[model samples]
Target chain A: MRYLTHKLIAFLIALMLAPVMLAPSWAQTPTLNIDVNVGIREPVPFAVPIFIAENNGAQAVATEISRVIASDLISTGLFREIPAAAHISGVSDFNAPVQFADWRAINAQALIIGAVSTSGGQLTVKFRLFDVFAQAPMGDGIQFTGTEEGWRRIAHKVADTVYSRLTGEAGYFDSKVVFVSETGPKGDRRKRLAVMDHDGASLSFLTEDNAIVQSPRFSPNNREILYTSYESGQPRVVLMDIFTLQKRDFGDLQGMSFAPRFSPDGTRVVLSISNGSNTDIYAIDLRSGARTQLTSGPAIDTAPSFSPDGTQIVFESDRSGSQQIYVMSANGGEAKRISFGDGRYGTPVWSPRGDMIAFTKILGGQFHIGIMRTDGSNEKLLTRSFLDEGPTWSPNGRVLMFFRETPGADGAPQIYAVDISGRNLRMVNTPSFASDPAWSGLLQ
Target chain B: MRQLSKAAALAALLITAACSNTGGLFGGNGDGTDVNGLNGGPIDESSIAYFQQTIGDTVLFQVDQHTLTPEAIAILNQQAAWLNANPTATVLIEGHADEQGTRDYNTALGGRRANAVSAYLVSQGVADNRIQIISYGKERPLAVCSSETCWSQNRRAVTIVTSGPGV
Candidate 1:
């Protein structure tokens, strides 16, 4: 009888263990169902007050740093910057002891402070982040030294440091954004290649032309750009040195080349090549110009992007009768349709993190910014507007930059950025209209 | 007069056919292919209106800038003449960017292209209310064959005349 009881007890224990062990396997099996993405709500709030100057005449620099930091943080839609007027404690000095009680009164969970000094033409800046509730510095303070012309950069570095410490993601501040610059009327529009600091400072035009250029993508090293230009009159992919402004076109191709992007290693370029009426995505070695075609179909395939690991590519194709995003092996295998929703997806840009791909989706005549997993799961639409396209990620993947066109009394496009959380949608000001924002990785 | 109209219509038809072939004036096929190879669709009325008004001419810009060229100013001056004559006409300045930059920059380039024209027309006594600008960026092309000839043709802004409301 005792042996019988032991067997029954053993059976009960095994039954409990079976469900626990089998749960993950059941979850892993593939199934077909429409997965609607309900997005995150109520982003965390933090306070970014102007860092106190270590000396006199540093107030302007301090103020500018604080303002830019606030803008960067608030723009991500993850952190809400506390208004200076609402602050219970005024920060008077960078080294001054913090009054945690005052910050807690205003419900600030995290705080940032910094100090700037100038000596020998190089600006030395120090900053600290704190967890107010824990009453401890979030991380050790760091210092930066650079020319006065790089003050904005110092601010960006500070913002990046704070962002990384808080979110555990890479920082995109201190990066450069390269795009086409324009002037003139519609039929007579003049375009020049241009680069600017990611925050929209230090603008420089790279090309002089009616030489048409399109889709300039920065190398992973951030030293070069691969773009398509009409300099020779036919559409061809060209490589340009960012520092020297020297450019060279890729060799002898039968068809037109456009939508050029770099592999994560920057060794090969993925672009769409058109021969007569046929268009397909091809990978070409930057040095040898040896080419490999990834797709061969009657339909057009363009906008090829390499997944972070360089193992697969996500691109836009009209293979299914309308534009949609597709995933395929990096070496050109059978392509799988990943976007199975109601809208058309274009410009599928694989995220730097390798986990999600960002894209522009058009549905019901409205353009939206959206993200989905690498395999096309968990698709989340981040922003919707009258017109929004060309999404590029901040180095940390927290923010996206794209152009927003509000039909002016006269129809012209305006540039705008929205956080991935679908908040903090605001215009990114330019002297003229801006679009096709390609965010650079953080300048190391 | 009938011959003149037929010749004008034939010229208009040819120009429309060319513009539609480039895929710049109306919505692009949205496939981001060579604009020159886009011979898939018919030449619609909008392309005809765009061509007859400009007669295959587009605005011009100076080197490395989207600011209107003197030729563009003259075109707008002429456009002001045509719009004043047709009081019911509303103009949509479709913007184009040269193929030389990134797509986003080209979109902005296209906008600046439109803005330069819109601003000039406003100064030339065209009601800002009657003019609208839409930047198609490098998505539309007047030339699809890879060549400087095609690129130059692609880098243009064309003024499209629409009958305001109820037309």
Candidate 2:
């Protein structure tokens, strides 16, 4: 998905230093599973030492990378970092044998050993995971080579490797998030499109704040973004090359387009189109620029999301008298209403795992971020506040990122993340007020 | 980060809006009151301010409802009359919503409200060519409070007088 204009200096060539790591073993780690009742369980203690720097200029970034890796695991709430001060021994060499007794003395269940080297403008990172309790390496070690500026990505990649190895699920650490950055008071707010690392690192502004923007969604490949822009003085859907920041109107510009999302294959985009009155879902072929109207009704339908398989789409519509979630074939037909027994439901995002749907629900005047099955059963409300909407699933489908706004003159919207179990709610940092967060899939 | 838009330009017209006060009556508090007794731009019946203040340029709607109320219809009726009298004045209708609802649905709801108002103005003999509409949804709020006191005023469609052609 990288465009020609996106001259990425960093190229991560993952080297299989220890060939046994090639096959991921799910049976080795049985301690970490998101499905388990996390409330009753204690966090597994893990330790990551300062990564060894193989050459000059690698020392500072090495320590920073290891710190980020530790931060990533700790933020999940499922893993606890045993501070470096608590460690009995420090790893000074990449190939040195781990002294399990020293780590076990500090009650460290898991250990991360990593090394970094810089040469010819290429930064190389290598890491291995160990189960201190089991007294053995959990898997073989692996290494990655990239440009120096890509150190953060490399660090996240290392974190992802460690997380997936321990959790038996793919890691979301190396992903990007697209959201709207807001400034000014409520009466005269200026919103701009923005992107950042999943951990809120490396913030970048994609557009000037002259126009209002909302609900930016990442394409499956993470190279493009589809969002609604008021730059034309009317709401229109614009597709932008994330690398170049070049944008073009999407679909037929005759009517207003907004709430756009890409299909799993990335060949088509589904979005809501309004002709100054009624709004409906429509799909456009990216290569051909041909548009297909998916819904025909007077009911207001806007938020549209594609299932991971690309065979079904889930969206919110007031067709049933109130805003609710509905699912239909990707080709479009009679959509079966999946959300029931709610104050109202909208912004229904299908999880990448394809088992559940996350949504924004309002009842009793209190807004909530909720999740339910694709068949619309087992609805679980995760977070409740004055206002919470627009839930975007993490790459692993274990967490959701949404926005919550406060009341009064000084009130503004900020992004928040919550787990599916309704535990561990934390605000994602941004330069200013940000909302309508869209989480991207794991980056290449 | 603090860029202003057209709605900010129309701040002079919202003196009597429901939520906040402009400190005092229009032209009396600030902006240099006319000492010669004859003001320019704002006081004329056909002027943007007169149409904005006297004829009433904004129509309010209820929560989650885009269907025009009797009160909204009355305002649109007056707007149509004002537009017909000033043939050279084209109108830009901005539709807005409160922060009570989600973003996307509110946007479409705002659109429906603006369209309903435009349709009413057109039915009353206001030329369709003289009307243009934009939905700000819940993005732009006139009032800062989160209660119904502010919400009611925020959910509105305003008619701004522009010169020449439609926006």
Q: After superposition, how far is residue A356 of candidate 2 from its true place, in Å?
A: 0.7
lDDT of 1 by residue, B52-91 (tens): 4443337866422566767777777877766665666676
Candidate 2 positional error at A151, Å = 1.1
TM-score of chain A of 1: 0.84
Mark the regions of model 1 whose C-alpha exceeds 4 Å error after superposition: A1-49, A56-59, A85-93, A406-409, B1-167
- For each candidate in the order shown, give its overall lDDT on alpha carbons: 0.69, 0.82
Interface RMSD for candidates 1 onward, in order: 14.5, 3.1
Candidate 1: residue A160 lDDT (0-100): 77
Show model 2 residue runs off by greater than 4 Å. A1-40, B1-43, B164-167
Q: Which 10 successive residues of model 1 chain B have the least lDDT summed?
A: B42-51
Query: Candidate 1 lDDT, tens digit per residue, A1-444?
Result: 334323322221221110011112222211111111233355456788777777676768878878988877665666777788889888877778889998888888778877777666556777777788777776566777666556776777777777777666667777878776656543345666766766676566667756666668899887788887766545678999766667888787765577889999889999987642346899999788799989998566878899888999998877786778999999998999999999778888988878888998888767788989988899989888766777887776767787665432233455677766676777776666566667777665
